[model samples]
Target: MKNMNQLITIAFFVLSTNFFAQDKQDQQNEIVAVWITADETKIEIYKEGNVYLGNPINSKGERNTKIEVLNLEYTNGKWVGKIYSKKRGKLLDVECLVEGDNLLLEVTTRFISTELEWNRAKS
Candidate 1:
């Protein structure tokens, strides 16, 4: 009887862990929209099929800039992707997290690390 109870406890823990992970994934998946940074830079985030992308827009709402975020995939509780730097003309690895009303992005490279905070834009 004690062994049976232990087995049931282990099963419950596994199920609950999966449930919470799925919940977090669902929340992260809902980040398909436009967001504004603290410096008023406008970025439009969208998903094309399974690929998540981001582009910067100008005052005229034209996506004339190069893609900012590309090939984003939700994995291990965060969005892992690549960000294109127009100034440097290079690609950098990026990780994104949606925290409360903010989207936190971290960009990393061999010698540089950048963190950006963005809020969902109001339509």
Candidate 2:
């Protein structure tokens, strides 16, 4: 009887650990949805084929803006995104974040500063 109790305890512990691990992975793999203020276009960004692709999520439009992501850096418990736009045929530098149901996108060029808020979508 004691051996059976020990085995059950071990099984519970292992299952709990796996559940937590999967939850963490789900959080990390979440996609950040964005809406560009320049043209009111909705874009969904996902890491696909080992690269980042931004597509019009709900509405379709002629969009030619995409920055290849090299790495994702986190700071102060916030998700920070960095991308290279020179290779994507754009002259914009972006550093943005996703917090709860809000996204703050910062774009800068030689002499332009654009900051916009992106409300998250309910899924």
Candidate 3:
């Protein structure tokens, strides 16, 4: 009876761990899609290995060309990363969250922090 109870406990622990890991993966994948900024710039967000990256697909300025605007990794139940600021001419700390059809990105710097919203592009 003791051995059987121990086996059941171990099995439950393993199953619960697997379930939570899978759930986190699903949450992380939700950000993988094309998002459009308020200025109508299209950014494609994709996963490369364990990290998520975003790049602009369509923009007129040379600054927006062939640059990784976003580099994110999931940690502590949030997506933490750095985003390239074209205006600031550098990369800044960014946190990303998906709320409904909007992707909220908070960019922080030494002096100020601001949030930008990007809408998920329709397929």
Candidate 4:
């Protein structure tokens, strides 16, 4: 009976350790970017920490919006979030994922897609 209890404890600890390690790994691989599309212009996003701040830097070189970060979702290997644009006064959702050495981004509501090479910024 004592032996069985010890085995259960050990198994629990091992599983907990692995789960946490995987969570840390997933956080480390998150991505942030300034996405550009033909119609809407730009979107600024941060995947990890579930943070997002979207604003159009320049719409045809003219200011057109006030933007703020909204609640974003962060999955182990996926990012999906929505941003509120002051110019349009609306929210737009986007999805992103890592594929090998490239980053995949798609704004389904807008039907726009882009693939950008991953460049690690000096931390």
In model 2, the Cα lDDT at residue 64 comes to 41
- Would you estimate the TM-scores of all the predictions? 0.68, 0.53, 0.83, 0.44
Tens-place lDDT per residue, model 4, 1-123, is: 999999999999999999999987666445554555435455444543545444444646432345453336666557677645445678767566655434455544467543433332233
Q: What's the true lDDT of residue 112 in model 2?
A: 80
lDDT of 4: 0.55
- Give the worst 10-residue stretch by lDDT in candidate 3: 58-67
Who is ahead in lDDT, 2 or 4?
2
Q: How would you encode candidate 1's per-residue C-alpha lDDT over 1-123 as one tens digit per residue?
A: 999999999999999999998987677677777888777888888777777888888889876446564568877678898977666789888899888768898989887889988999887
How well is each residue in 1-78 modelled by candidate 2, as lDDT tens digits? 999999999999999999998886566555444444335545566555444455554435444444333234433434
Residue 87's lDDT within candidate 1 is 60
Every candidate's CA RMSD: 4.7, 5.3, 3.5, 6.7
Give me the displacement of residue 86 in model 4, in angstroms. Answer: 9.6
Backbone clashes, each candidate: 0, 0, 0, 0
Index of the highest-TM-score prediction: 3
Q: Candidate 1 regions off by >4 Å?
A: 1-25, 62-68
Which residue pairs show backbone clashes in model 1? none
Relative to the unseen true structure, what is the C-alpha lDDT of residue 74 in candidate 4, on a scale of 0 to 100?
61
| TM-score, candidate number 3 | 0.83
